[model samples]
Target: MPNSLRPSSRAAASSARSASLADVAALAGVSTGTVSRAMSKPEMISEATRVRVMEAADRLGYVVNGAARALAMRRTKTIGAVVPRFGSSSFPAMIQALEATLAEQGYTLLLSAPEGRREKEPDILRAMLERGVDAVALLGTDQPPAVLSMLAAHRTPYVQMWAPPGSGSDAVGFDEHAAGAQVVAHLAALGHKRIGFVGGRSKDSERARHRFEGLALALARHDMALDERAIIETEYGFAEGFTAMQEILGRRTPVTAMVFGTDYLAAGALAALDQGGIAVPQALSVASFNDNDFAAYLHPPLTTVRLPIREIGEAAGRLLLARLGGEHFEPPPMHVELIVRRSTGPA
Candidate 1:
């Protein structure tokens, strides 16, 4: 029988032996090294030839051994990122940007979250290290000492995202304190004398602490004071913001405006005000940091600080690639802008 009529020969060979690079090379009419290059470093190979090799490998059910490849290349071509929480607030946008940038350069991303527990970050990072990730990106510079020491011991190249300039570490982010001061300035300009703040726990979030500090500084500048009772520290969640707002209202403090550390929290506060029949920008004005996607769609539109989240993520990815490429340079600090919407007015 003709070879086309009878698949016995090819089927018998495929069944008898596990496919190897040489087998794929033979089927694609390429050399073994070319086949290897096509799989590991496809950029160096022409597209047509790469397609031929891939098709031959698929037909033979050939699977590249990542362990073997790593051993040979001394790289897994994978990058890892550790954040406080995934799918929370603005992190999803940052992660998407990071993933897209890395994919363009033939790298994969491995993400991890500490589930709001800073103490667990070190263990999570150690696990990523053990998995042979090429490099790592941390969310902020406020990492546990153990985590910093571990990264130092491993000599891993890392960059911190959402951190300020001159943070004494490789980072790509904006200044949270300045962002907070901007909000206060806006409120003060609107004739708001009494402003309350709803935010997350200062101990768990450096960003929140800086924002609160900035608020206090700006309040003093405006000859105003933040009522100790008006400042509520809660978790970084919508429910937490709602409850904090409710508690502040219960205190009956003469707060004409509210500044939230994040837009997510501000959103919750808005919900509470709506439910309590409080007219925003009339009875009270609201401002927040982080102009997340939902901010513009909120009732009355949220007035917030517009952080370059996606740009920061993309910059972080580029920094990692530069390190891998043996290029070194300090990145400039990103800037934040104030977005005035319907949420804030004369108070």
Candidate 2:
């Protein structure tokens, strides 16, 4: 057939379908491999070829197929993250920091919506792994065996956030148990004898369980105990905190102070206390964890444990980046301070 009988190169590049690497290579007068190198590792190709391929790609409105690129490179440059739930304040804050830190290193964050059920974690993580994520970021230190096994089978690099320093994976967090102990010690030092605890479910939440344990032990040290009648374990929510506080009040346990697992819960409990005509620190001292910005902004200004949340997130991201780079990076130690505010006082 005559050259005129064949489709023109420009017309072929402008086909209705999305332009492919072949079209770009053809338009740039280069090979498909050269186009790949020019798009991915431009340094590997000549500047002239790289610019020509880029211009052709631009003209064709060609978008790099991430999946195909990952297939060729064996890395997606994305880190998958799955947390217990998004209902809490701290995780979201930590995630934001993690995303920003990862962005600094040019890694996209791929999040799994909810690791609500422990049993569902395997599926969630599996979906993430199947997407060719370079690494994973989990909320807790311990994972169900299936999840761990799957990760191992795939040889995926993973790190845990807000977890104790163990479990055979890179982890970044302050000691949850210590945070609890600090909170109790602060309240007890203020002469709070009868302290009630409101927290997320301990059965599935490792952090909650650790905090509960710390509170119990610290209360023991102070000659008090975690009173069952006054303790309420609920989901991570403001309304839940409010309801839990009301329930604690109904228990008739006569507590002088209340400790919440997180600032979100503390906020709700404060609302409940205010609505119930109880004065903070004056009537009942209230303290909690995660010194979120709102903690200082609350009416009574919560007395809580100030976690290095964003720093922890940045550290976690750095740990993963180090792992990817095959460099040695320690999970830096983070401290949690007992921020004494007007929310707590003499009992």
Candidate 3:
């Protein structure tokens, strides 16, 4: 027989009956209401009574049924957020902002990540929904179709972060395309004609694709074109960026400057360039997106676009709150700016 099915010496006492709130109240010499208040709203009861009720509950092994309480209130008072990844990115800071803002509103945040597998997003989202999350916040508009469909069917209030507003959904983010264009224009103004771009696969990320599109537009405006051989695509990581940079350098196309998808990747590329004895801003001017925490501390400092990650997260939380409150208003697009650091210069 399975261990669970086997009887033990304590089985008779355990199988007698599970403890209930009434049982706890009886032992504490209080009413069931008092016990309930002590567990749910301790401030409403005296400290001594709360302690007695708690002790009775502990003695009886009684546990509060959160699911029952949530059902009665018609809300779990919990918000969920799905991010792409966590470490070595701005997501952690953004999540912190979300948690802080939500806590102020008496709501808790449940965070989930796909662990680098886009296909696993739907399952993660489904799990959140099953847990009775009051609302959800998605990292970007580029969510899996199944996840979107499930969210729509569930009629859950949700907002998209890190993307522009007015996409038939509540969103709190800046225009990635515009930021990309600004970087390219800045490089062009510095007289970098032979430029290269190293980034993740465009198909996997709408933000990356928009940035690339913006770069293309800027290049066209400057009467220049991206060298086909100079474009390198890989996973979004420092090591990947380093390897991509080495590949771009080996192409013999004489790239005078480079643009990366993120500062993390830019840092990796910088390390690779340093190993090759290539001086930044002299041998190759480099720029990228997202002025992350480490962007300024880099050896030469990174010339990148600053995306207001924390602000976007707080705004996303507010948008969800507004949705829950049944308010209909679109937020204006957040602005991004180019930060000219030492990483890029005249080619």
Candidate 4:
């Protein structure tokens, strides 16, 4: 029997979708072998035939059986991404850059959001390996020791993102601590002291914690004290900012200025303060990290420290692509910028 007489690698996938390669071949007006050759090794087939076969496959909505291909060729041509969650602004941008870069070199991105930070890194690595991912990208470098050991054992190429100084793995990120410090310094230089901190939980994000620490360092430099009640932890959203502001408002001594870990939180604070009938910059000054797209749209606009998310994403894509191409390059520490805007003034 000809190789095409046997089931094609995509047969199982077709069955799952209730379609078949015969369906593709018949629709293409070509032989089964022609369809197989066109789909598997397009370079060996005539351009007209390849086009016809691809069009038919597209019309049929054929799905590639990555598992079978991985078994046959020992390559899945896919990279895995493990992040905190999907649909977030930052992760999606990074994924887009990575996917575009991989597609340019004939690869795909297989995404998995493990709900939250993986507590069992070993199991997570095992799951990706089981799926035959060529590489994996993790959101941060705060993995458990066993997870790091698992990666070393598998000898897979992995990249860690959003890291601080002295990262353990190959990484692409900026100094979160320095970013926080920059915001505090910017606020202080504008004559605002007695700062409050609003941010995400310290346990989940080392970067968030570092930002808070940077705030402390900057305040210390100015002989300022951040009140105990002024530090509020939220779940990295706008709602958290609102809650943090409520707590701040309830304080005995009102804060003069505030720095937040993210613009999302800052936006919440702005709304909360407005609802409380408090004036901004006159009664309270506010600054935040992550000079996100919406930062400039607020009533007074936000004074924010730029996170360099796009640059980091682009750089991450380039790094992964170069590695896939067998080229060696060191990952660089990207920098953050402070964008002084109207949200902050004398306090």
Every model's TM-score: 0.90, 0.84, 0.81, 0.82
TM-score of structure candidate 2: 0.84
What RMSD does model 4 have?
5.0
Best by lDDT: 1
Residue-by-residue lDDT tens digits, candidate 3, 87-194: 667788888988888887768899987666789888998999999999999877888899889989999999888875456667777777678778888988888887
Best by TM-score: 1
Better of 1 and 2 by TM-score: 1
Cα TM-score of candidate 4: 0.82
Rank all candidate structures by their TM-score, best first, as comma-separated numbers.
Answer: 1, 2, 4, 3
Q: In model 2, what lDDT does residue 53 have? A: 79
Error of 3 at 255 (Å): 1.5
Q: Give me the displacement of residue 62 in model 3, in angstroms.
A: 11
lDDT tens string, model 1, 125-174? 99999998888999888988998898889888888988876776478888
User: What Cα-based lDDT does every candidate model obtain?
Assistant: 0.84, 0.83, 0.83, 0.76
Model 1: residues with Cα > 4 Å off, grouped in runs: 1-12, 15-19, 58-61
Q: Model 1's lDDT to the true fold?
A: 0.84
Backbone clashes in model 4, listed as residue pairs: none
**Lowest lDDT block of 10, candidate 2:** 1-10
List candidate 2 segments past 4 Å from native.
1-61
Which residue ranges in model 3 land beyond 4 Å of their true spot? Answer: 1-65
How does model 2 fare in lDDT?
Answer: 0.83
For residues 96-209, write the lDDT of model 2, one tens digit per residue: 889998988768999876747888888888888877889999887778999879888988888888887564447787777788889888877888788888887888788888
